[model samples]
Target chain A: MSTAVLAAPFQAVFDANSQEFSLAGVIRPRSVDEIAYSITEFRRAIDEARGVLYINVKRLAQMNNTAFHAFSRVVLDACRTRSDIRFVVVTSSVVGWTERMFHHLGKIEPQITVEVYDSKFYPGQSFVEDTSFIPILRAQTKMTWRHERTILPRHGMRPGIAMADICCGIGDFAVLAQKEFQPARIVALDHSKPSLAYARKVAAEFGVTGIEYTYGDASEMLLEDNQFDFVTCRHSLQVFNQPELLLKELYRIVKPGGRVYITNEKNSHCLGEPRAQSIQWTYNELARLLSHFEMDVELGPKSRRYLADAGFDDILVESFMITNLDGDPQDFADVIAGWEKMFAAMAARHGEAPKFIDRFRQGFRDHIFAALHPKGYAGWPIWAASGRKPL
Target chain B: MNAAQRQPAEAKFEPLLQFEMEMGTFLSDWHHCDQLSNFMARMISHNRTDPVRHSNFFSSALNELLEVSFRGGSPEGRIGCSVFRQGPKERVRLSFPCSPTQRRFFGEAVARTHKGDAYARYLDAISTDLAPSREIVLLDLAINFDAEIRLEEDDPPSISIIVDLPLEGIVS
Candidate 1:
């Protein structure tokens, strides 16, 4: 529970359970006197706090020097007087300035520390953000596009609608959607700077326009509510430890009556010919490997349940298989090769025994061999789901 | 060199957006600082690689400059802002009415911000018993945004504060 103090253009809430005092909205008073009540309330909360006191300014969109100076005084004074409690100032990278401003405060007092909220939001971010994985991401998109292009229209995707592609790694999907759907606007957002940079470069090289590539944390995005007619977070939810948080954000951004689309993979269901048993064992182990890292590689079939729980009507969910014959068998083989490099490295880093690693490596090599063989067949399954926000 | 002397060649920057209003109208409400910065940031940031992140940083830096101008400028003449872009660098020129005293204050504050120890001086300024000075805010833009700030006073009773921000490069 928390106590709320409402101030014009801003509000302060103190959660007694967490000892966090959160300040949100615009707090740009002309002078300190204008916000004396808030300042006093802030001081009171600090006084009554114990152990650690959190000053959360993650949602503060605007603040002036006057407000900063005033709040800094209270915080500084509290630090000097209270030796038992540590002061932590929580900021967001989305706001851009809060971290720098509060970092100065941290320098002034050793007891004060600044924490950027979204820094640790994604546990599996490092694995996918590797630039070496770019080629495989492109190939995977090429394989999925054959199915999604037809499936998207049935899920309410139409030309001239405003759309957002959350977690748009390297942004190939946005570029393809722009050509096919002609969205009035496209905001392709991702947390990886390198990926976004590559995406922008690719868009520029192709002379693609109208897609606004942006950097953001998907779970705690700064995007305003109800902004887009269609919001798609593709092959992303499975990578997060908390898929519900991502689903909540997707639900928040889509307009009323608009739809939220998502796609994920069930690694354990991936199948190949001839060496089918080895492939099944390896994929089951792959799911466990990802689970150990707080990721859900088996979230494909669970998409419908996730969307329904997120409060959407007219739920639609379907599955598609990307076989070696989708377009070119080489593309399918190349994707497995990339996955082998990434997952094998990850398993090694997790300290798996060399014998287990060898067997794991063999499964991928066999899968790739099957993908490239003349009489062999290999398939990867994906689930595409969407739900409409209630009107 | 002074702001006027250090001004980049006009042809190098392409102007993106500009807004003008009477200083009296602008200073009448403190909210204008937030509103104008946010509006301008959104309008200019769409074409950038990461529009949302760029706009957040741009708005924060622009809001500080506007707040400083609101506090230090004379409320009698027009206040105009023009934004320009050159590659990753974005430039904002704020021209407003000022008294001779206000001009000296901004001139010295901007100069102080360019000093090597501006971050330390900013910390000292904010921690003092007195109210936060305009220098503290200016140093914020200079230090945090890695901005190049200058004051141009060629027009009498009116001065232009020019801030060149590498907004895209800074955010990441």
Candidate 2:
């Protein structure tokens, strides 16, 4: 009866009446002890999830506040009670929380693993993460039915085939592959030993059987020559200094009649002669390299090029905008603020060049974050194109 | 396996021999190891501690880390620690097999003379290299300190004893 002392200010946000909401943003803690306490609360939230919630955190060391400890414990408790609670927490800048979360989840839901993302998109949106990143990225990532709804529309997973994922960062795509079609053999390979080790442990815990998490430079593993079927790469084509070597590696590894899929993010707003030339150097060069792989290449728009370039048949590109601003000036201003800081960061890094900076600013104005708030500019257009490696 | 090649008996580098037997390998390149980080270089040393007849209360606790670092990873990696002493702090190094462990794992350097200077003599004669690995990974033990955990090597084994946390014996 006298539980007012137990009540917290953030507890007000956990309206029992509100069916479900995403905890997509950052909540910094004040102390390390507080960090321990918050983990307990998030556990409660996962246990009692009226619906699935996405936690927006970067790393564990960054999480030191007492309030954050209470918050995390609530979320975790909620995950335990609810069956649909898919703990899709991104672990990059946050290590301690991830460590604790992994320790607990590794013991409990080892079968139902956590999905880790590189967080390449929304690089400068940490402040907005509080109310936005979790939900928007979930809808964007399609934790609910993202794979069945989007990827299924393009590349149909028939059942019983080894799906090779090159540069498998923290096992996101592999988790998706296991959940949906239950691919017979999933060869997930990455260069990072720690990443591979964690992925191996997660895969083992999550009961992702028949999936082998291996360590090697995808383009240069010292294994068999042509040893995979349906090789796939996502959002990592641009990072490699030598895209042609990777493409050649793909050509050599992918079986006859097997397909190769590659995806690279192309910023719609960032373009001009000099800027276009840079994109040409990075993004365009990969496409140019893909053209050399004996298979017929079909380059779809930015969103759909990965599956398409692999020579998948019937390639289609669909563009979706993240525009969901509810007339709240501050909210929209936050989105606008998010964009301003974003462009400022880019401008600072590259310099105040017209085509690169101005064009991107206009795109931000026309379609990326604030102006496209209605569609959630969470994405300008998500590319999806299917190409079949000629059987 | 040759007793003649081991520590305390070998007189030439006898101190260094006694040091190596206790500390395992001398990480000459310990400073370059990736397991630990830069800031830790100033703190924890990997040499042997001084032989001041530590009470059974302390030696019993100090032995846990001795077996783990050496036997936990590989046989070649297995290390047994030699104890040392100062007023509040102690140092122990994991010297290589066949090398004596006069090197300091903790406390201060050994001094050349001790006329009436015990601490200075301890620092000069006992301690080995101070500036080793700069890396300080929480999971690393090649250089950085490890809590002494007494356990049988059984998978996620069970801990039978715990080393005295400096806090317990320090304040009281």
Candidate 3:
């Protein structure tokens, strides 16, 4: 929810260039000016965190040392000027050569805070994994951007607690959770063998032993009730056949003071009529489910109202927008148009994804082109909702 | 175990030798820009191992892979690299990347390096021992950097390079 809150003022509300499906939540900004406004709002939000920064160091190789050291000077200045600027080196690597070099490079800039925010791609993935564009447009994504995502990070996560990532695909959240909280125990839950295998390789490579890998249906894991300090459900919740039952399960495992977190497609349409009805139904059931059990829930963008109805007193919502758009939209569109195709191509011997994504390619382009003339493609929805289970 | 002893039996090492895969179109781009000044200040010892993959004169098994990348528009191949006991498990972390290459170079400098257990086999063996716990971070950077290289429908997305520095840096 913090992300939504932090990014809403900064996130582009609509896009004019889109020509694909323009469902409500997927609405696009009619002009670049609208997006520019959102980007400014985002920058202001980022600036709110004293001593925090948003660095654009994509081409590390070509980046000049003068500019490199110049940024370090600002970081150092933040440390010198602000007492809370005690953090240092937000690196993506455990001890990446980049971080190592930064350590030596910034040695001249004393009082500098550095933190490495590396892409902890679950267990077996890399920060620089697949970047082919075709599959990007093929994803069946429906995440939304909400206005109240800033409550938590501003509040900051509860320190010294463990995190449990249910259905931890490729261990992305597991790595992020470890980075965010430095949680003593990061229990990664998943069922697929290959996914589990991939997760295992990642956990090992990044030396994230703090995480314990568990393979199984997360809803059925033999974990203790109220065992987790924080529970996060990423893109996995919407796919559940029984979302309400799972919410109850999530509520049950979170300790009284702990938080239950869920994020979903952030499109505005997801918040609309019948589809919203399904969401409302989930929330309503959560309310009924919790009242019977004497538990309170929080409803962020990801939650159903039933959570608030179920007696969650303090609720929060937010958004996180990473301005990285290098992935292939066609690939993404194909994944959404047809998931099985990518699955088959993944195990293909050669670059055989084209075969599976072939037919959908024209449709994907046609859809985007279609959206552009009409209004724009559907805006992927991403909603985040969280609430505390009262102690 | 010593390098010779650690060597996987032929059956075991066969799979290791045939290991390889390239990502996206980075290889073709990298090949074209191979002479571009190395980015990081440190000298990275990156060597494009033989056959460029499974196809080189080294083996017939690669026959399947060669038909793929050359004919197929995708990046694909199976090349092999390995790890083994170059140091005690504790000290192994530090010596890991270097020791294996040294073990290969130490046995024989050039020409015959890929010959037998002394060189090729040793490289594969070392990769096995270094059960390094890997970590991956999936970043959905909103902009496609490759758009700078290749674009489909429109102009590539431009990354706004904003360098935030307080105005006081100039006055001081």
The DockQ figures for the candidates are 0.45, 0.01, 0.01
Q: lDDT for each of the candidates?
A: 0.88, 0.38, 0.35
Alpha-carbon shift of residue B145 in model 3 (angstroms): 53
Candidate 2 Cα outliers beyond 4 Å, as residue runs? A1-140, A143-150, A153-156, A192-210, A269-347, A353-379, B1-172
lDDT of 1 at B34: 76
As a whole number from 0 to 100, the lDDT of residue A132 in candidate 2 is 29
Is 1 or 2 the stronger prediction by lDDT? Answer: 1
How big a share of the true inter-chain contacts is recovered in candidate 1? 0.67
Ordering by lDDT: 1, 2, 3
Model 1 chain A: ten consecutive residues of lowest lDDT:
A1-10
DockQ of model 2, rounded to 2 decimals: 0.01
Residues A40-140 of candidate 1 have per-residue lDDT tens digits of 88988898899999999987867778888899999888888899989999998777888888899878889999999877667787897788999999999
Please list the residue runs of candidate 3 whose C-alpha ends up more than 4 Å from where it truly belongs after superposition: A1-156, A266-302, A309-311, A319-363, A366-378, B1-172
Instruction: Report the lDDT tens digits of candidate 2 across residue range B32-51.
Output: 11112111211222121211
A271-346: candidate 3 lDDT, tens digit per residue: 2121334333333333333333222232225365735654454777655532112244343334333423332243
TM per model? 0.89, 0.34, 0.34
Sliding window of 10 residues with minimal summed lDDT for model 2 chain A: A1-10
**Which prediction has the highest DockQ against the true structure?**
1
